[model samples]
Target: MCKITEELQQIAAELLKEGKVDLVLGYTKGEQEEQSVPCIVTQPEDASKLIFDEYSEKALSKYLLEESFQDKKVAIVLKGCDQRAFKLMQDESRLGREDVYLIGVECPGMKWGEDLSPFCLHCDYRTPAKEDVDSLLTGADIPEAMQGEPLDHEDSFTDINRLEKMSKEERFEFWKRQLNRCKRCYTCRNACPVCTCRVCVFDRENPDYIDRAKDQMAQHQFYHVIRAFHVSDRCVSCGECARVCPEGIPLHLLNQKLLRELDKFYGEYQAGIDEVPTPLSHANADEPDFFGKEGKA
Candidate 1:
C-alpha cells in the first residue's frame, strides 16, 4: 500500500466527517483484476479501499462531465495529466470550481509498454501545487535531486523523423496503410478526454460523412483527419487513444504531429492551462503571415 493512500484517505475522511464533500472519488483495486479503477466512497470506512499506482490510468476528471455529479461536492484524485484536464474543464465552465475538492499527487512518469505518454514524458508540472487542491500527497519529499532541475523535454519524434524523411507520396502512403486497419470502432475517440460531445459527428444518423462501402482510403482519411482536427488545440497528449486502440495503431503519431504544428504555427501553448486560453479558441488580428499572398496558392 502506498503511504500517499493513507494520507489521502485521512484527508478525505476529515472532509466527509465535516461535510466538506458529499463523495470522495478515488482509485481502488478492481475486483478480479490487478488494475485499478475509479471508485466513489461516501463513507469514511470505504476510504481504506482507495489505492493508486501505474494502473491508475483512467482520468478521474471524466466523471465531472457526467450528469449525476452535477451540483455535488466531489473529491477527486489527480495525476499531472488529470489535473490539466480538470483545469481545462473549470476554465471552459464545464465543471464548477466549488463543486470539486482536489487531492493532487506528484506523478513520476507513468510507463506504457514501450513509450510514455507525451504529456508525462515532457511534463513540467509533475508536482501538484495547484491552488484549488485542498491537500496534496507525495510518495517522497521534494528531493534536491528532483527540485530546481528542468524536466526532460527531449523530443520523442523518432517515428515522426522517419516519416518526415520519406517523400510526400511515401508519407501519404504510409498513413493510408496504417489507417486502413481501422475497424471504425472509435476506441480512440472514446478514450480521449477532449473528444467529449453529446453526439459525435462520425456517428450522426441522417447526414453521413462516411459511405456504406467504407472506401479504405476514405475511411482512413475521414477518421484520422477528423480526430486530429477536433483535438488539435485541446489535446493534452495523454496517449489514451493509442493505449485503447485494439489494432495497436500508433495514433499518438498523428496527435504529436498536430501538436508540433500548433507549437510551430501559433506559439508554445499547452491545452489546459488555466491562465491562458488555447490558441485555437481565440483569434488575433495581428497574427503572423506564414503563408504570404504569393505563397497562398
Candidate 2:
C-alpha cells in the first residue's frame, strides 16, 4: 500500500508539472493518524502530500461540481465507485469528460478499525472500469491477504429483507422509532452525491411545502420519504448518507428497499454503469406499476 501511495503521488506531481491539469484532487493526511481527507493540489511540489489507504473513504468526485474547480482541467484520484460519479455528471450535462483527467486506483477496500466499511464490503469492482482513465494504479494480487473482505449483495441486504417481513403497521412503527431520533440536521442530504440540485426542496425558504420542525413526526417522515423517492432511480448505494449521520440511522435501508422494489417491478437496474437513462428519467405508458395509483396512504 505504501508503494502504491508513492506511485500515486509521483503521477499527480507529473500531471501538475506537465500542466496536464490545473488542479489535482486527491487525499492528504487527515488530523487522525489513520484517516485521510480530500485535497486539491495546485502545485507540483504539493503532490507529494497525496496518499491512499484504508482511510480514503470520502468520495472526491462530488467536489468537481464546486465553483472553485469549474471550467478548469482537473485530475482526480478515483476508486471504482467514485469514478461512477464522473459518468453520472457527464450524462447529466453538469460536467464534460474531456475537461478532466482520471487517475484510476485499484481499491483494496477501506476500514474503520477492525470493521470494514459497508459500501466496500458490498462492492466487487476493485479497479476503476472507466475507459478514459489517463493512468491506473494496481493493488496487490492476493485477495484475502489484502484489506477488508468483499461481500455479495445477499449479505448486504440482510437488514432490507428483515424489514420486508414486517406487517404494514409494524413497518411503520419501526420507521417511526428510527426516524423519531432524527435531529433534522440534514447531514444526509448534504453528503449525498446524487442530491446535486442547485436548490434542494427541503432547503427551500418557504415553510408552506413542508414544516421544518424537528420534534414533529410528520416533518421527519416527510423529509425522509420525499428524499427516498427523489433518489430511487439515481442512487448508486454509495452509503455516504448513512455513514455521515450522527444519530446512527440506517438511512441506507430506505434506499435499498426502493432499489429492491425497482428491481422486482422493472427488472434489476444498477445506476452509473452506462449512459443509459434511468427509469425515472423517462415517461412510458408501459411502465410497471409496483403500487397502484390509489395506493393506501
Candidate 3:
C-alpha cells in the first residue's frame, strides 16, 4: 500500500472518531480488477476501506452536491482539480464552505501510460495549495517521484487539429465517422460534475430549445456544445467526462480547449482559487478584447 493511502486512512479515521465529520467521501477498489469507485463511509471502523491510487480518477466533489449529502457535515478527499470544482461551487453559492471539510491531497498527476484520459495529460494544477484547503493531508510540495514534466496544453487537441487541417469536405467526413460511433448514451454528460442543472437543456421536453426533427447531428451538437458552455468557467479538468464515456471519446479535449481559451483571454484563473473570481462569472470593462471587435471600431 502507498504511504499516502495510509495517511489518508489515518486522517479519515481520526475525523470519524472525533465526530469532525458525519461522513467521509473517498475511493475504494471497485468490483472490477482495475477500477476504483467512490465510497461514502460513515463509521470510523470503515475508514480502512478508503484507498487512493492511479485508478482513483473520478472527482469525489460531485457526490458532495447530491441531495444525499445536503446539510451533513462531510469530509471529502480532493485532488487539485476536485478542490478547484469545490471552490467554484462555493463561489457560485451551490455549496456552503462551512458545511464541508476538505482534505487536500498533493496529486502527483494521474497515470497517463495506458489509455490515459485527455484531462489528465493537460492537468496543470497537480499540487493543492495549503492556503486554499481546509487542512492539508499532504504537504505543499509535490514529490519528486510523482511529478511529470508539464505537458504542452496544445498537445491534447489532436482531433481538433486534425479537423482544422482537413479540407472542408474531409472535415465533414471526419465528423461523420466519429459521430457514427456515438451511441447517445449520455454517460459523458452524467459523469461531468459541472453538468448539474436540475433539468438539462438537452432533454426533449425543454421548450426553450427543442429539436422537433430529432436529428442525430442536432442531438450531438447540442449535447456537446451546451455541456461545454455550461462548464466553461467552472470546469476543474478532472477527466471524469472522458473516463465515463463508453465510446472512449476524448471529451476532455473540448473542456480543455475552453479552459485554455479562458486562461489565454482572461488570465490564469482556476475554478477553485478561493480568492479569484471565475472569469466568465465576473467581467471587467478594462480587459483587452481577444476577439478583435474593439480594433475594427
Candidate 4:
C-alpha cells in the first residue's frame, strides 16, 4: 500500500470513531485482481478498506445527491475530476459543502486494464486545491509511463478532430451506425457525475416527454441529443460517459464537441475551474444563431 492509502485509512478511522461523519465513502478490492470498487465504511474498523489507486475510477460524489444522504454527514474520497463534479453540484445548490467532508487524493492517472485511460492522458488537474478539501493526500504511486508532462489543451482534440473534419453526410452516417448499436442502457447517464436530475425524462412514464420505446433510431438520437445539450456546458471532461458505455460508444465526443464550440464562443471556460453561469446558462444579444432564426424565440 502507498503512504496516501495508509493516511486515508487513518483519517477515515478517526473520523468514524469520533462521529465526525456518518459514513466514509471510499474504495476497496473488488472480486477480481487489480479491481477497485466503491464501498462505504460506517465503522472505524472498516476504514482499512479505503484505498486510492488507478483502478479506483468510479465517481463517488454523485452518491451525495441520493435521498438516503439527506441531512447526514458524508466523507467522500475525491480525485481531481470528481472534485470538479462536487464543485458543480455546489454551484447548482444541489449539494451543501458543510454536509460533505472531502478527502481529496492526487490521482495517479486512471487505467483501463494495462493501458492508461484516454481521458486521464489529457487530464489537467491531477490534484485538488488544499483549500477545497477537508483533508488532502498526495504522493500517488505513479507509473513511470504516465510521468510525462500533461497534454496541451489545444492539442487535446487530436482524436476529436478526426470526426469533426468528416463531411456532413459522412458524420450523419457515422453517428447512425454507432447509435444503432445503443440499447438505451442509460449507463452513461448513471455514471455521469454531473447528471444530477432527480427524475430523468426517460424514467418517467409521461408520453409527452418521450416514449419508453428504445428500438427506434429517433428514440436513440433524441436521448443523446437532449442529454448532450443538458450537460454541454457543465461537463468536466471526466470521460465517464464514454468509459462506462457498454456499446463502446464514444459518448464523450458529443460533449467535447459542444464544449469546444462553447469555448470558442465564450472564450476559454472549464466547468469547475471557472465560476457559475456557464456559457449555455445565458445567451448574449450578439450570440450567433446556428439555425439562422432571427428575432424569434
Candidate 5:
C-alpha cells in the first residue's frame, strides 16, 4: 500500500473501532492496477481495505446523497476538491455538518498522465479548513517542481490565454468539433456531486425539454449547454465530470468558461468556499447589472 493509504487505513480503523462513525467511505484498489474505486467500510477490519493515491480520481461526495446514509453517522475521506462538494451539500441543507466526520487528506493533487491536472494549478484548497474537520491528515502533497504544471492532454484548455485569443468563429468551430462526439451517456451528470436532483430532467420518462428521439449535433450541444448553465453557480471545479467522460470531451473547460464569465460580470466568486450566495441566487437593489444590456437582445 502507498504511505497515505496505510495511514488512512490506520485512521479509519481507529475511528471504526471507537464507534465514532457507523461507516467509513474511502478508496480501494480497482480492477486495474492504476485505477481506484470508492469503498464503504462498516467494520473495523474492513478499514484495512482503504487506499489513497494519484489514481483515486473519482469524487466520493455524491455517495452522501443516498437516503440510507442520512440517518447514519458517516466518516468520509476528502481530497481538496471533494471537500468543496461536501461544503455545498452542507450549505444547501442536503446534509447536516454535525452528522458527518470529515477526514481531510492533504492533497498533493492527482495526476492525469505524466503531469498534474489543470484544475490543481488553479486550486486554492490544498487542505480543508481546520475548524470544519474532525481530523486532518498530512498526505503526499504534489511535488514542488510539479505543483503548477498542466497535463498536456490534447483537449486541455489550461492555457486560458490562448483560448481567449481565438476569434468567435474559431471558438465556435472548436467547441462544435469537440462536442460533436458526445454520445449522451450522462456519465458527466452522474459523476457530478452538485447534480443532486432526485428526478433529473434527463432521466424523466419523457424529457420534453430535450429531444429524446436521436442524437444530433444540435441535441448534443443542447444537452451540454443546458447542463453547463444548471451547474455554473454550483460547480466546485472538482473536474470529475471531465475525468469520467469516455469520449475524452474537455467538459471542465465549459465550467471554467462559466466561472470566468461569472467573475468578469460579478466581480469574482468561487463557489463552496463559504456560505455566500451564488451570483445567480439573488441580487441587491443597488447592484449593477452587467448582463442587463445583453438581455435586451
Candidate 6:
C-alpha cells in the first residue's frame, strides 16, 4: 500500500476501534490496479482495505444523503473539491454537521486516464481547509513536489474562453454535437454533489418534465440545458459531472459559462466557498435583467 494509504487505514482503524464513528467511508482497490472505489468499514480490521492515491477521485459526501446512511454517525474521506461539496450540503440543511466526521485529504490531484484531471490543473486548493475538517492528512503518498500546494489558477477558464471565441452558430453546433450523444443516463447528475434535489426534475413522472425518448434530441437538449441551469449557481466545479459522463460530454462548460455570466451580472461568487444565499437565490433591482421585463428586448 502507498504510505498515505497506510496512514489513512491507521486513522480509520482507530476511529472504528474507539467507537467514534459507526463506519468509516473511504476508497479501496478496484478491479484495476489504478482504480479506487468507495468502501465502507464498520469493523477495525477492514480498515487495511482503505487506500488513497490519484484514483481517489469520487466525492464520498454524496453517500451521506442515502436513507440508509442518514441515521449513522459516519466518517468520510474528502478531497479539497469534495470538502467544498460537503460544506454546501451542510449549508443547504440536507445534512447534520454533528452526525458526520470529515477526513480531509491533501490531494495530489486525481488522474484522468494518464493525464491529470483538467479541473485539477487549475485547482486552488489541494487540501481541505484546516478548520473545515476533523482530521487532515498530508499528501505524503504523492511526489514531494505535489504535496498539497495552492495552484496559481490564473488561466482557469481557458476551455470556456475558447468556446466564447466561436461564432453564435458555431457555438450552437458545438453544443449540439455534444448534447446529441447524451444517453439520458443521468450519470452526471447522479455524480454531482450539489445537484441535490430530493426529487430530480428529470425523474418526476407526474409532471413528465422531460420525456426520455431516445429519438427525441429536442428533449435531450432540454434535459441537458435545464440541468445545467439548475446547478449553475450551486456548482462547486468539482468536475464530477464531466468526469462521470459516459458520453464524454463536457458538461462543466455549460456550468462555467453560466457561472461567468452570473459573475458579470451579479458580482463574483463561489457557491460552496462563500456563505449561503446563492447568486440566484436573491436579486437586487439594480442588477441587469436579461429577460428585459422593462421592455428593452
- Provide the RMSD of all predictions against the true structure, rounded to 1 decimal: 3.2, 3.3, 3.4, 2.2, 3.5, 2.4
Put down candidate 4 lDDT per residue, 1-297, tens digits, no spaces: 898899999999999999999999999989988889999999999899888888999999999988898978999999999999999899889999999999999999998757988688788787888999999999988877567877677676866788889999999999999998898888999999999898887788766565756677898899999889889999998899988889999898899888898888778888887889778788777876677666556
Candidate 6 global TM-score: 0.93
Q: For residue 93, what is the lDDT in candidate 4?
A: 91
lDDT by residue (tens digit), candidate 1, 1-297: 567777887888888888999999999888736467889999987778887766677778878788888878899998777887788878887778777889998765554664444556556777556675777888833334344644454466677888999999998888887887888788898778877776788888667677544557886788788898888888876778888799888898888888888787787777776465787888887777766658545
lDDT of candidate 5 over 189-231, digit per residue (tens): 9999888888887777674666554547787888999888889
Task: Kindly give the stretch of ten consecutive residues in candidate 2 with the minimal lDDT sum.
Answer: 140-149
For model 4, where is the 10-residue window of minimal lDDT? Answer: 206-215
Candidate 3: Cα lDDT at 87: 75
Clashes of 5: 2
lDDT of the structure predicted as candidate 3: 0.75
Candidate 3 to truth, TM: 0.85
Number of the predicted model whose TM-score against the real structure is largest: 4
Q: Residue 225: error of model 2 in Å?
A: 1.1
Q: lDDT of each prediction vs. the true structure?
A: 0.77, 0.81, 0.75, 0.88, 0.81, 0.85
**In candidate 6, what residue range of length 10 has the lowest lDDT sum?**
145-154
TM-scores for every candidate against the unseen true structure: 0.87, 0.91, 0.85, 0.94, 0.89, 0.93
Order of the predicted models by lDDT, top scorer first: 4, 6, 2, 5, 1, 3
lDDT of 2 by residue, 1-297 (tens): 476798998998998999989989999999988888999899999988999887787888888889988879999988877777667777888888898899988877777457767777677665777474788887633336344556767778899888889899999999999999999898888787777788789878775666657688888888899888888888877788898889888998999888888877776777777555876787777876656888687
lDDT of 3 by residue, 220-291 (tens): 666677778888877777877777777766677677778877787778766776455678767778888667
Q: Model 5, stretches more than 4 Å misplaced?
A: 146-161, 211-214, 290-297
- Tens digit per residue, CA lDDT, model 6, 64-156: 999999778999999888988888889889898899988888888788887888788667766788999998988455543454554554366
lDDT of 6 at 235: 82
